[model samples]
Target: MLPDFRLTDRTVPSAIEVYGIQGNAQYVARKAEKQALYAREGAPCVEWIPPDDLASVQLPPAA
Candidate 1:
């Protein structure tokens, strides 16, 4: 199954308009074909940065 990409009319003023909530629970279930799934098991929530940081975040050099 393909990953779900949520889109709105929101336009981000960045070089690339990459956007969305990634890999939600439903997405995982679908991708796993309803089989037993595993995430971080007992991991804590990730402390994500603010949205604006995404615009300026530098990507790794292309391989």
Candidate 2:
């Protein structure tokens, strides 16, 4: 499992920012086509947030 460095209870991200949204049909169509291709290939699309963006993701104190 990928760790959430935000120290959040969010199991999954509520939103993801996609690459482009210039309102151009061709661009949007190409992006969708690529997504479909990846899906058919059983590839997973993932997003990322730098660890530095979060407050803390340190190891917990030992008991």
Candidate 3:
């Protein structure tokens, strides 16, 4: 018999820093879409799957 398992939870952050309002909304939508797609494809984890353009950003040093 197959072992019982529970899916991991992936939740998007409530706020994001983008160039503009539209960009922030777009980013959130993209994140949600990716999570849904991975869930549909039966992914065990979503950490390794980076979102598009996310890897290209360079953050400033922490004050």
Q: Tell me the tens digit of each residue's lDDT in model 3 across 24-54.
A: 7775686567556656866433232234466
TM-score, each model?
0.21, 0.41, 0.35
* Model 2: CA > 4 A from native: 1-18, 47-63
Question: Lowest summed lDDT over 10 consecutive residues: which window, candidate 1?
Answer: 8-17
For candidate 1, what is the lDDT? Answer: 0.32
Cα RMSD for candidates in order:
12.0, 10.9, 13.8
Task: Give the per-residue Cα lDDT of candidate 2 at 31.
Answer: 62
Q: For candidate 1, lDDT tens digit of each residue in 1-63? A: 122222232232112223233558774445344222213233111122346565565532332
Sort by lDDT, top down from the best:
2, 3, 1
Which candidate wins on TM-score? 2
Q: How far is 50's C-alpha from truth in model 3 (Å)? A: 14
**Clashes per candidate (backbone, < 3 Å):** 0, 0, 0
lDDT of 2 by residue, 1-63 (tens): 122222223343222224334577996776677567656865444423243344433332232
